[model samples]
Target chain A: MWTRIRDFDRMIQAMDLFNSRLGGVFENYQRPRLSAGTWGVTESGPRTNMYDTGENLEIRVEVPGIKKEDLSVKLQGNYLEIRGTRKAENPEGYTAHRVERGETSFTRSFTLPSEVDAGKVEASLKDGILTLILGKAEPAKPKQIVIS
Target chain B: MSERQDVTVREEALSERNRQIPTVAPLVDIVENENEILLFADMPGVDKNNISINIDNGRLALSGVREVKPVGAVIWEEFADVEYRRTFSVPQSIDVAKVNAELKEGVLLLHLPKAESAKPRQIEIKVG
Candidate 1:
Protein backbone atom coordinates (compact mmCIF):
# COMPACT_ATOMS: atom_id res chain seq x y z
CA MET A 1 0.00 0.00 0.00
CA TRP A 2 2.82 2.42 0.86
CA THR A 3 4.60 1.80 -2.44
CA ARG A 4 1.40 2.36 -4.43
CA ILE A 5 0.70 5.57 -2.55
CA ARG A 6 4.21 6.81 -3.22
CA ASP A 7 3.87 6.05 -6.90
CA PHE A 8 0.58 7.93 -7.02
CA ASP A 9 2.19 10.93 -5.35
CA ARG A 10 4.97 10.93 -7.91
CA MET A 11 2.50 10.82 -10.76
CA ILE A 12 0.65 13.80 -9.31
CA GLN A 13 3.84 15.78 -9.03
CA ALA A 14 4.74 14.99 -12.64
CA MET A 15 1.35 16.12 -13.81
CA ASP A 16 1.60 19.36 -11.84
CA LEU A 17 4.93 20.12 -13.48
CA PHE A 18 3.53 19.53 -16.94
CA ASN A 19 0.53 21.73 -16.31
CA SER A 20 2.67 24.62 -15.01
CA ARG A 21 4.98 24.43 -17.98
CA LEU A 22 2.08 24.52 -20.40
CA GLY A 23 0.62 27.48 -18.56
CA GLY A 24 3.89 29.31 -18.81
CA VAL A 25 3.91 28.88 -22.58
CA PHE A 26 0.49 30.46 -22.87
CA GLU A 27 1.29 33.26 -20.48
CA ASN A 28 4.30 34.27 -22.50
CA TYR A 29 2.03 35.18 -25.38
CA GLN A 30 -0.59 36.83 -23.24
CA ARG A 31 1.72 39.14 -21.33
CA PRO A 32 1.08 42.77 -22.17
CA ARG A 33 3.79 44.64 -24.05
CA LEU A 34 5.43 47.72 -22.62
CA SER A 35 4.52 50.78 -24.66
CA ALA A 36 7.37 53.04 -23.60
CA GLY A 37 10.36 51.33 -25.15
CA THR A 38 11.57 50.80 -28.69
CA TRP A 39 10.78 47.20 -29.59
CA GLY A 40 12.93 44.80 -27.61
CA VAL A 41 13.64 41.18 -28.42
CA THR A 42 10.65 39.03 -27.57
CA GLU A 43 10.99 35.50 -26.22
CA SER A 44 7.53 34.08 -26.64
CA GLY A 45 7.42 30.53 -27.94
CA PRO A 46 5.33 29.36 -30.88
CA ARG A 47 1.74 28.24 -30.50
CA THR A 48 1.44 24.47 -30.84
CA ASN A 49 -1.13 21.74 -31.42
CA MET A 50 -0.81 18.08 -30.42
CA TYR A 51 -3.23 15.38 -31.43
CA ASP A 52 -3.21 11.63 -31.78
CA THR A 53 -4.55 9.65 -34.77
CA GLY A 54 -4.30 6.15 -33.22
CA GLU A 55 -1.50 5.21 -35.63
CA ASN A 56 0.50 8.38 -35.41
CA LEU A 57 0.83 11.39 -33.13
CA GLU A 58 0.92 14.74 -34.91
CA ILE A 59 2.20 18.08 -33.68
CA ARG A 60 1.66 21.38 -35.44
CA VAL A 61 3.46 24.54 -34.36
CA GLU A 62 2.78 28.08 -35.58
CA VAL A 63 6.01 29.95 -36.32
CA PRO A 64 5.39 32.73 -38.76
CA GLY A 65 8.27 34.64 -40.42
CA ILE A 66 10.82 31.95 -39.68
CA LYS A 67 12.80 30.06 -42.27
CA LYS A 68 13.00 26.26 -42.43
CA GLU A 69 16.77 26.35 -42.01
CA ASP A 70 16.52 28.07 -38.62
CA LEU A 71 14.48 25.38 -36.90
CA SER A 72 15.62 22.21 -35.17
CA VAL A 73 13.65 19.27 -33.71
CA LYS A 74 14.88 16.44 -31.54
CA LEU A 75 13.28 13.49 -29.81
CA GLN A 76 15.02 12.30 -26.65
CA GLY A 77 13.26 9.35 -25.04
CA ASN A 78 9.62 10.44 -24.79
CA TYR A 79 10.36 14.15 -24.85
CA LEU A 80 10.13 16.11 -28.07
CA GLU A 81 11.99 19.43 -28.26
CA ILE A 82 11.55 22.20 -30.78
CA ARG A 83 13.94 25.14 -31.06
CA GLY A 84 14.13 28.01 -33.51
CA THR A 85 15.32 31.56 -34.01
CA ARG A 86 13.79 34.35 -36.09
CA LYS A 87 16.00 37.22 -37.10
CA ALA A 88 14.52 40.69 -37.40
CA GLU A 89 15.33 43.03 -40.23
CA ASN A 90 14.32 46.67 -40.62
CA PRO A 91 14.44 48.17 -44.08
CA GLU A 92 16.98 50.93 -44.65
CA GLY A 93 16.04 54.62 -44.71
CA TYR A 94 12.78 53.86 -43.00
CA THR A 95 11.44 55.55 -39.88
CA ALA A 96 9.33 53.09 -37.95
CA HIS A 97 6.07 54.64 -36.86
CA ARG A 98 4.83 51.53 -35.07
CA VAL A 99 6.94 48.49 -34.32
CA GLU A 100 5.33 45.42 -32.79
CA ARG A 101 7.45 42.62 -34.21
CA GLY A 102 10.94 41.81 -32.94
CA GLU A 103 13.65 39.21 -33.13
CA THR A 104 12.80 36.06 -31.14
CA SER A 105 14.31 32.74 -30.15
CA PHE A 106 12.36 30.00 -28.44
CA THR A 107 12.57 26.42 -27.24
CA ARG A 108 9.57 24.27 -26.38
CA SER A 109 9.49 20.66 -25.20
CA PHE A 110 6.65 18.16 -24.82
CA THR A 111 6.31 14.66 -23.43
CA LEU A 112 4.54 12.03 -25.48
CA PRO A 113 1.50 10.27 -24.06
CA SER A 114 2.34 6.94 -25.66
CA GLU A 115 5.36 5.10 -26.93
CA VAL A 116 6.65 6.43 -30.25
CA ASP A 117 8.96 4.91 -32.85
CA ALA A 118 11.88 7.29 -32.98
CA GLY A 119 13.15 6.01 -36.31
CA LYS A 120 9.93 6.76 -38.15
CA VAL A 121 9.42 10.35 -37.07
CA GLU A 122 9.03 12.95 -39.82
CA ALA A 123 8.91 16.74 -39.72
CA SER A 124 8.09 19.39 -42.27
CA LEU A 125 7.61 23.16 -42.33
CA LYS A 126 5.00 24.79 -44.51
CA ASP A 127 3.57 28.31 -44.42
CA GLY A 128 5.36 28.95 -41.11
CA ILE A 129 3.77 25.89 -39.52
CA LEU A 130 6.00 23.05 -38.41
CA THR A 131 4.40 19.61 -38.51
CA LEU A 132 5.75 16.49 -36.82
CA ILE A 133 4.40 13.01 -37.47
CA LEU A 134 5.44 10.32 -35.05
CA GLY A 135 4.53 6.68 -35.56
CA LYS A 136 3.29 4.85 -32.52
CA ALA A 137 5.09 1.78 -31.33
CA GLU A 138 3.17 -1.46 -31.65
CA PRO A 139 1.98 -3.02 -28.43
CA ALA A 140 2.63 -6.67 -27.69
CA LYS A 141 -0.29 -8.93 -28.50
CA PRO A 142 -1.38 -11.83 -26.35
CA LYS A 143 -1.29 -15.35 -27.72
CA GLN A 144 -4.61 -16.89 -28.73
CA ILE A 145 -6.08 -19.43 -26.34
CA VAL A 146 -7.65 -22.66 -27.71
CA ILE A 147 -10.83 -24.00 -26.08
CA SER A 148 -11.13 -27.78 -26.55
CA MET B 1 -17.02 63.97 -49.39
CA SER B 2 -17.15 61.11 -51.85
CA GLU B 3 -14.20 59.38 -50.16
CA ARG B 4 -15.92 59.39 -46.80
CA GLN B 5 -19.09 58.00 -48.37
CA ASP B 6 -17.10 55.26 -50.09
CA VAL B 7 -15.45 54.24 -46.81
CA THR B 8 -18.78 54.02 -45.04
CA VAL B 9 -20.26 51.90 -47.81
CA ARG B 10 -17.27 49.57 -47.80
CA GLU B 11 -17.43 49.11 -44.03
CA GLU B 12 -21.14 48.29 -44.23
CA ALA B 13 -20.58 45.79 -47.00
CA LEU B 14 -17.71 44.08 -45.17
CA SER B 15 -19.61 43.69 -41.92
CA GLU B 16 -22.69 42.38 -43.69
CA ARG B 17 -20.75 39.87 -45.76
CA ASN B 18 -18.62 38.52 -42.89
CA ARG B 19 -21.35 38.28 -40.28
CA GLN B 20 -21.61 34.52 -40.48
CA ILE B 21 -17.99 33.62 -41.06
CA PRO B 22 -15.72 32.59 -38.18
CA THR B 23 -12.79 34.95 -38.40
CA VAL B 24 -9.94 36.28 -36.27
CA ALA B 25 -7.91 39.45 -36.49
CA PRO B 26 -4.26 38.61 -37.14
CA LEU B 27 -1.43 40.23 -35.24
CA VAL B 28 0.11 42.98 -37.33
CA ASP B 29 3.14 45.28 -37.35
CA ILE B 30 2.99 48.55 -39.23
CA VAL B 31 6.06 50.64 -39.99
CA GLU B 32 6.44 53.81 -42.00
CA ASN B 33 9.53 55.25 -43.66
CA GLU B 34 10.17 58.33 -45.77
CA ASN B 35 9.36 56.50 -48.99
CA GLU B 36 6.81 53.84 -48.04
CA ILE B 37 4.94 52.03 -45.33
CA LEU B 38 5.27 48.35 -44.54
CA LEU B 39 2.68 46.11 -42.91
CA PHE B 40 3.22 42.58 -41.68
CA ALA B 41 0.46 40.26 -40.54
CA ASP B 42 0.71 36.78 -39.15
CA MET B 43 -1.78 34.36 -40.68
CA PRO B 44 -0.69 30.80 -40.11
CA GLY B 45 -2.15 28.05 -42.34
CA VAL B 46 -2.96 30.60 -45.03
CA ASP B 47 -1.64 29.98 -48.52
CA LYS B 48 -0.77 32.50 -51.19
CA ASN B 49 -3.73 31.57 -53.36
CA ASN B 50 -6.31 32.10 -50.62
CA ILE B 51 -5.18 35.58 -49.59
CA SER B 52 -6.72 38.75 -51.00
CA ILE B 53 -5.81 42.41 -50.56
CA ASN B 54 -7.98 45.26 -51.70
CA ILE B 55 -7.49 49.02 -51.51
CA ASP B 56 -10.46 51.32 -52.01
CA ASN B 57 -10.72 54.98 -51.04
CA GLY B 58 -7.67 54.79 -48.77
CA ARG B 59 -8.99 51.71 -46.98
CA LEU B 60 -6.74 48.66 -47.14
CA ALA B 61 -8.57 45.38 -46.58
CA LEU B 62 -6.90 42.01 -46.09
CA SER B 63 -8.57 38.64 -46.00
CA GLY B 64 -7.20 35.10 -45.93
CA VAL B 65 -8.80 31.67 -45.74
CA ARG B 66 -6.98 28.79 -44.11
CA GLU B 67 -8.19 25.28 -44.87
CA VAL B 68 -7.40 22.62 -42.32
CA LYS B 69 -6.59 19.18 -43.72
CA PRO B 70 -6.58 16.24 -41.36
CA VAL B 71 -5.53 12.82 -42.64
CA GLY B 72 -7.35 10.71 -40.10
CA ALA B 73 -9.72 10.84 -37.16
CA VAL B 74 -8.61 13.51 -34.74
CA ILE B 75 -8.38 12.29 -31.18
CA TRP B 76 -7.51 15.76 -29.93
CA GLU B 77 -7.62 19.24 -31.38
CA GLU B 78 -6.25 22.59 -30.25
CA PHE B 79 -6.42 24.70 -33.38
CA ALA B 80 -9.68 26.05 -34.76
CA ASP B 81 -11.09 26.62 -38.26
CA VAL B 82 -10.86 30.39 -38.30
CA GLU B 83 -10.37 32.75 -41.22
CA TYR B 84 -8.54 36.12 -41.03
CA ARG B 85 -9.81 39.57 -41.89
CA ARG B 86 -8.49 43.03 -41.08
CA THR B 87 -8.74 46.51 -42.50
CA PHE B 88 -6.68 49.66 -42.09
CA SER B 89 -7.38 53.29 -42.94
CA VAL B 90 -4.42 54.41 -45.02
CA PRO B 91 -3.39 58.01 -45.50
CA GLN B 92 -4.22 59.81 -48.73
CA SER B 93 -0.52 60.22 -49.45
CA ILE B 94 -0.16 56.51 -50.18
CA ASP B 95 0.27 55.68 -53.86
CA VAL B 96 -2.18 52.79 -54.08
CA ALA B 97 -1.21 52.06 -57.68
CA LYS B 98 2.37 51.22 -56.68
CA VAL B 99 1.51 49.05 -53.67
CA ASN B 100 3.03 45.57 -53.55
CA ALA B 101 2.11 42.51 -51.52
CA GLU B 102 3.69 39.14 -50.85
CA LEU B 103 2.70 36.11 -48.85
CA LYS B 104 5.48 33.95 -47.45
CA GLU B 105 5.44 31.24 -44.81
CA GLY B 106 1.91 32.16 -43.78
CA VAL B 107 2.83 35.80 -43.25
CA LEU B 108 1.51 38.64 -45.39
CA LEU B 109 3.66 41.69 -46.18
CA LEU B 110 2.18 44.78 -47.81
CA HIS B 111 4.26 47.68 -49.03
CA LEU B 112 2.51 50.99 -49.70
CA PRO B 113 4.64 53.49 -51.50
CA LYS B 114 4.33 57.23 -50.86
CA ALA B 115 3.04 59.53 -53.58
CA GLU B 116 5.33 62.12 -55.24
CA SER B 117 3.79 64.90 -53.21
CA ALA B 118 4.33 63.06 -49.94
CA LYS B 119 7.98 62.18 -50.56
CA PRO B 120 10.63 64.42 -49.04
CA ARG B 121 12.43 66.77 -51.42
CA GLN B 122 15.93 68.12 -50.86
CA ILE B 123 16.50 71.80 -51.65
CA GLU B 124 19.83 72.84 -53.19
CA ILE B 125 21.74 75.68 -51.53
CA LYS B 126 23.27 78.40 -53.77
CA VAL B 127 26.28 80.38 -52.48
CA GLY B 128 26.64 83.83 -54.13
Candidate 2:
Protein backbone atom coordinates (compact mmCIF):
# COMPACT_ATOMS: atom_id res chain seq x y z
CA MET A 1 0.00 0.00 0.00
CA TRP A 2 2.83 2.40 0.80
CA THR A 3 4.53 1.68 -2.51
CA ARG A 4 1.24 2.25 -4.35
CA ILE A 5 0.80 5.57 -2.56
CA ARG A 6 4.31 6.66 -3.55
CA ASP A 7 3.63 5.73 -7.19
CA PHE A 8 0.41 7.75 -7.12
CA ASP A 9 2.25 10.73 -5.67
CA ARG A 10 4.86 10.58 -8.42
CA MET A 11 2.12 10.41 -11.05
CA ILE A 12 0.41 13.48 -9.58
CA GLN A 13 3.69 15.42 -9.63
CA ALA A 14 4.33 14.49 -13.21
CA MET A 15 0.83 15.59 -14.18
CA ASP A 16 1.29 18.91 -12.40
CA LEU A 17 4.52 19.54 -14.29
CA PHE A 18 2.85 18.73 -17.60
CA ASN A 19 -0.08 21.02 -16.79
CA SER A 20 2.23 23.95 -16.04
CA ARG A 21 4.13 23.48 -19.29
CA LEU A 22 0.87 23.32 -21.22
CA GLY A 23 -0.25 26.52 -19.51
CA GLY A 24 2.92 28.27 -20.66
CA VAL A 25 2.38 27.18 -24.25
CA PHE A 26 -1.23 28.35 -24.16
CA GLU A 27 -0.20 31.70 -22.71
CA ASN A 28 2.28 32.24 -25.50
CA TYR A 29 -0.33 31.37 -28.09
CA GLN A 30 -2.89 33.72 -26.58
CA ARG A 31 -0.63 36.69 -26.13
CA PRO A 32 -0.46 39.23 -28.94
CA ARG A 33 2.65 41.19 -29.82
CA LEU A 34 3.66 43.89 -32.24
CA SER A 35 6.64 43.38 -34.49
CA ALA A 36 8.32 45.12 -37.37
CA GLY A 37 6.84 44.58 -40.80
CA THR A 38 8.75 42.26 -43.10
CA TRP A 39 7.97 42.66 -46.78
CA GLY A 40 4.29 43.31 -45.92
CA VAL A 41 3.76 40.03 -44.13
CA THR A 42 1.99 39.38 -40.84
CA GLU A 43 3.46 37.16 -38.18
CA SER A 44 0.40 35.20 -37.15
CA GLY A 45 -1.14 32.57 -39.36
CA PRO A 46 -4.78 31.48 -39.41
CA ARG A 47 -5.86 28.03 -38.23
CA THR A 48 -6.91 25.52 -40.90
CA ASN A 49 -8.65 22.18 -41.40
CA MET A 50 -8.08 19.67 -44.17
CA TYR A 51 -9.99 16.50 -45.02
CA ASP A 52 -9.98 13.81 -47.66
CA THR A 53 -13.23 12.60 -49.21
CA GLY A 54 -11.77 9.70 -51.26
CA GLU A 55 -12.68 11.46 -54.50
CA ASN A 56 -11.84 14.95 -53.39
CA LEU A 57 -9.96 16.90 -50.72
CA GLU A 58 -11.40 19.84 -48.79
CA ILE A 59 -9.53 22.55 -46.97
CA ARG A 60 -11.10 25.10 -44.63
CA VAL A 61 -9.47 28.14 -43.11
CA GLU A 62 -10.68 30.63 -40.53
CA VAL A 63 -10.24 34.31 -41.49
CA PRO A 64 -12.60 36.69 -39.79
CA GLY A 65 -13.27 40.38 -40.56
CA ILE A 66 -11.90 40.15 -44.06
CA LYS A 67 -13.79 40.96 -47.22
CA LYS A 68 -14.04 38.38 -49.98
CA GLU A 69 -12.58 40.83 -52.49
CA ASP A 70 -9.34 40.95 -50.52
CA LEU A 71 -8.68 37.21 -50.55
CA SER A 72 -6.76 35.30 -53.20
CA VAL A 73 -6.40 31.55 -53.69
CA LYS A 74 -3.99 29.80 -56.01
CA LEU A 75 -3.02 26.23 -56.79
CA GLN A 76 0.35 25.31 -58.22
CA GLY A 77 0.79 21.60 -58.92
CA ASN A 78 0.01 19.95 -55.58
CA TYR A 79 0.47 23.09 -53.51
CA LEU A 80 -2.44 25.34 -52.54
CA GLU A 81 -1.88 28.87 -51.30
CA ILE A 82 -4.33 31.25 -49.65
CA ARG A 83 -3.60 34.90 -48.90
CA GLY A 84 -5.73 37.66 -47.40
CA THR A 85 -5.65 40.82 -45.34
CA ARG A 86 -7.99 42.04 -42.63
CA LYS A 87 -8.29 45.83 -42.53
CA ALA A 88 -8.75 47.72 -39.29
CA GLU A 89 -11.68 50.06 -39.08
CA ASN A 90 -12.43 52.06 -35.98
CA PRO A 91 -15.21 54.59 -35.55
CA GLU A 92 -13.98 58.17 -35.42
CA GLY A 93 -15.17 59.30 -32.00
CA TYR A 94 -14.51 56.18 -29.98
CA THR A 95 -11.73 55.65 -27.44
CA ALA A 96 -10.38 52.13 -27.40
CA HIS A 97 -10.08 50.48 -23.99
CA ARG A 98 -8.88 47.09 -25.16
CA VAL A 99 -7.50 46.45 -28.63
CA GLU A 100 -6.82 42.82 -29.42
CA ARG A 101 -7.85 42.76 -33.07
CA GLY A 102 -5.79 44.59 -35.64
CA GLU A 103 -5.03 44.98 -39.29
CA THR A 104 -3.08 41.92 -40.43
CA SER A 105 -2.32 39.85 -43.49
CA PHE A 106 -1.32 36.21 -43.93
CA THR A 107 -0.25 33.82 -46.65
CA ARG A 108 -0.68 30.11 -45.95
CA SER A 109 0.27 27.31 -48.30
CA PHE A 110 -0.44 23.58 -48.12
CA THR A 111 1.03 20.66 -50.09
CA LEU A 112 -1.66 18.14 -50.96
CA PRO A 113 -0.83 14.48 -50.55
CA SER A 114 -2.52 13.37 -53.76
CA GLU A 115 -2.66 14.79 -57.22
CA VAL A 116 -5.77 16.93 -57.81
CA ASP A 117 -7.64 18.03 -60.90
CA ALA A 118 -6.85 21.71 -61.11
CA GLY A 119 -9.77 22.38 -63.39
CA LYS A 120 -12.29 21.03 -60.89
CA VAL A 121 -11.25 23.12 -57.87
CA GLU A 122 -14.01 25.11 -56.15
CA ALA A 123 -13.70 27.74 -53.45
CA SER A 124 -16.22 29.50 -51.28
CA LEU A 125 -16.22 31.93 -48.39
CA LYS A 126 -19.02 32.14 -45.87
CA ASP A 127 -19.20 33.38 -42.28
CA GLY A 128 -15.48 34.25 -42.48
CA ILE A 129 -14.51 30.65 -43.32
CA LEU A 130 -12.90 29.79 -46.64
CA THR A 131 -13.47 26.32 -48.07
CA LEU A 132 -11.61 24.82 -50.98
CA ILE A 133 -12.64 21.63 -52.70
CA LEU A 134 -10.09 19.98 -54.96
CA GLY A 135 -11.16 16.93 -56.90
CA LYS A 136 -8.62 14.12 -57.08
CA ALA A 137 -7.25 12.89 -60.37
CA GLU A 138 -8.60 9.57 -61.56
CA PRO A 139 -6.16 6.81 -60.71
CA ALA A 140 -5.28 4.13 -63.26
CA LYS A 141 -6.99 0.85 -62.45
CA PRO A 142 -4.97 -2.36 -62.14
CA LYS A 143 -5.20 -4.84 -65.03
CA GLN A 144 -6.58 -8.39 -64.47
CA ILE A 145 -5.23 -11.41 -66.39
CA VAL A 146 -6.80 -14.89 -66.79
CA ILE A 147 -4.43 -17.79 -67.51
CA SER A 148 -5.14 -21.57 -68.00
CA MET B 1 -37.80 38.43 -6.46
CA SER B 2 -38.01 34.67 -6.50
CA GLU B 3 -38.73 34.73 -10.20
CA ARG B 4 -35.61 36.81 -10.78
CA GLN B 5 -33.64 34.41 -8.66
CA ASP B 6 -34.92 31.51 -10.75
CA VAL B 7 -33.86 33.25 -13.93
CA THR B 8 -30.36 33.74 -12.57
CA VAL B 9 -30.17 30.08 -11.66
CA ARG B 10 -31.24 29.06 -15.13
CA GLU B 11 -28.66 31.34 -16.69
CA GLU B 12 -25.98 29.87 -14.47
CA ALA B 13 -26.90 26.39 -15.60
CA LEU B 14 -26.70 27.46 -19.22
CA SER B 15 -23.24 28.93 -18.65
CA GLU B 16 -22.14 25.70 -17.02
CA ARG B 17 -23.27 23.75 -20.05
CA ASN B 18 -21.39 26.18 -22.27
CA ARG B 19 -18.21 25.47 -20.29
CA GLN B 20 -18.51 21.77 -20.98
CA ILE B 21 -18.17 22.30 -24.72
CA PRO B 22 -14.78 22.56 -26.48
CA THR B 23 -14.66 26.32 -26.50
CA VAL B 24 -12.09 28.95 -27.39
CA ALA B 25 -12.17 32.46 -26.12
CA PRO B 26 -12.33 34.74 -29.14
CA LEU B 27 -10.14 37.78 -29.54
CA VAL B 28 -12.03 40.96 -28.69
CA ASP B 29 -11.58 44.69 -29.05
CA ILE B 30 -13.52 47.00 -26.78
CA VAL B 31 -14.09 50.72 -27.25
CA GLU B 32 -15.96 53.25 -25.21
CA ASN B 33 -17.31 56.69 -25.91
CA GLU B 34 -19.39 59.17 -23.98
CA ASN B 35 -22.59 57.71 -25.35
CA GLU B 36 -21.90 54.02 -25.52
CA ILE B 37 -19.44 51.16 -25.44
CA LEU B 38 -18.65 48.94 -28.38
CA LEU B 39 -17.29 45.38 -28.39
CA PHE B 40 -15.99 43.50 -31.41
CA ALA B 41 -15.21 39.79 -31.30
CA ASP B 42 -13.75 37.59 -33.99
CA MET B 43 -15.71 34.32 -34.13
CA PRO B 44 -15.09 32.45 -37.35
CA GLY B 45 -17.68 29.87 -38.56
CA VAL B 46 -20.37 31.28 -36.28
CA ASP B 47 -23.50 32.61 -37.89
CA LYS B 48 -26.34 34.70 -36.54
CA ASN B 49 -28.56 31.69 -36.06
CA ASN B 50 -26.07 29.84 -33.86
CA ILE B 51 -25.03 32.67 -31.52
CA SER B 52 -26.42 33.65 -28.11
CA ILE B 53 -25.87 36.82 -26.14
CA ASN B 54 -27.25 37.66 -22.74
CA ILE B 55 -26.70 39.95 -19.81
CA ASP B 56 -27.50 38.76 -16.31
CA ASN B 57 -26.28 40.02 -12.93
CA GLY B 58 -23.93 42.53 -14.57
CA ARG B 59 -22.27 39.79 -16.60
CA LEU B 60 -22.39 39.94 -20.35
CA ALA B 61 -22.05 36.50 -21.88
CA LEU B 62 -21.44 35.54 -25.48
CA SER B 63 -21.59 32.01 -26.87
CA GLY B 64 -21.74 30.43 -30.29
CA VAL B 65 -21.52 27.02 -31.93
CA ARG B 66 -19.25 26.66 -34.93
CA GLU B 67 -19.42 23.62 -37.21
CA VAL B 68 -15.88 23.48 -38.51
CA LYS B 69 -15.69 20.01 -39.98
CA PRO B 70 -17.75 17.96 -42.39
CA VAL B 71 -18.28 14.21 -42.53
CA GLY B 72 -15.07 12.87 -44.04
CA ALA B 73 -11.71 11.34 -43.24
CA VAL B 74 -9.59 14.14 -41.88
CA ILE B 75 -6.19 13.96 -43.51
CA TRP B 76 -4.81 16.98 -41.72
CA GLU B 77 -6.29 19.37 -39.18
CA GLU B 78 -4.84 22.29 -37.25
CA PHE B 79 -7.94 22.99 -35.22
CA ALA B 80 -10.61 20.76 -33.77
CA ASP B 81 -14.37 21.27 -33.51
CA VAL B 82 -14.66 24.56 -31.64
CA GLU B 83 -17.31 26.43 -29.76
CA TYR B 84 -16.81 30.11 -28.97
CA ARG B 85 -17.53 31.57 -25.54
CA ARG B 86 -16.54 34.75 -23.72
CA THR B 87 -17.84 36.84 -20.83
CA PHE B 88 -17.29 40.38 -19.61
CA SER B 89 -18.38 42.41 -16.63
CA VAL B 90 -20.76 45.23 -17.58
CA PRO B 91 -20.92 48.40 -15.59
CA GLN B 92 -24.17 49.63 -14.02
CA SER B 93 -24.06 52.69 -16.25
CA ILE B 94 -25.02 50.58 -19.25
CA ASP B 95 -28.67 50.62 -20.27
CA VAL B 96 -29.43 47.00 -20.84
CA ALA B 97 -32.68 47.73 -22.61
CA LYS B 98 -30.85 49.65 -25.32
CA VAL B 99 -28.17 47.08 -25.99
CA ASN B 100 -27.79 46.13 -29.64
CA ALA B 101 -25.78 43.50 -31.52
CA GLU B 102 -24.93 42.65 -35.12
CA LEU B 103 -23.14 39.70 -36.65
CA LYS B 104 -21.34 40.13 -39.95
CA GLU B 105 -18.89 37.79 -41.61
CA GLY B 106 -18.46 35.81 -38.37
CA VAL B 107 -17.59 38.91 -36.37
CA LEU B 108 -19.86 40.12 -33.57
CA LEU B 109 -20.36 43.84 -32.94
CA LEU B 110 -22.08 44.75 -29.70
CA HIS B 111 -23.27 48.23 -28.73
CA LEU B 112 -24.10 48.96 -25.14
CA PRO B 113 -25.59 52.38 -24.67
CA LYS B 114 -25.09 54.25 -21.47
CA ALA B 115 -27.97 55.09 -19.12
CA GLU B 116 -29.31 58.61 -19.27
CA SER B 117 -28.15 59.31 -15.73
CA ALA B 118 -24.65 58.27 -16.63
CA LYS B 119 -24.34 60.70 -19.51
CA PRO B 120 -22.35 63.84 -18.84
CA ARG B 121 -24.35 67.06 -18.49
CA GLN B 122 -23.30 70.63 -18.08
CA ILE B 123 -25.23 72.90 -15.75
CA GLU B 124 -25.86 76.44 -16.96
CA ILE B 125 -23.91 79.10 -15.00
CA LYS B 126 -26.15 81.70 -13.25
CA VAL B 127 -25.16 85.39 -13.80
CA GLY B 128 -25.39 87.42 -10.55
- The model with the greatest TM-score is 2
B-chain TM-score for every candidate: 0.79, 0.79
Candidate 2 regions exceeding 4 Å error are: A1-42, A140-148, B1-20
Residue-by-residue lDDT tens digits, candidate 2, B61-83: 99887766574788766555556
Docking class of 1: incorrect
Candidate 2 CAPRI classification by DockQ: acceptable
DockQ, per-model, please? 0.20, 0.30
Model 2, retained fraction of real contacts?
Answer: 0.63
- The C-alpha lDDT values of all candidates are 0.72, 0.76
The docking quality of candidate 2, as DockQ, is 0.30
Error of 2 at A35 (Å): 16
lDDT of 2 at A138: 76
Interface RMSD score of each model: 13.4, 8.2
True contacts kept of 1: 0.51
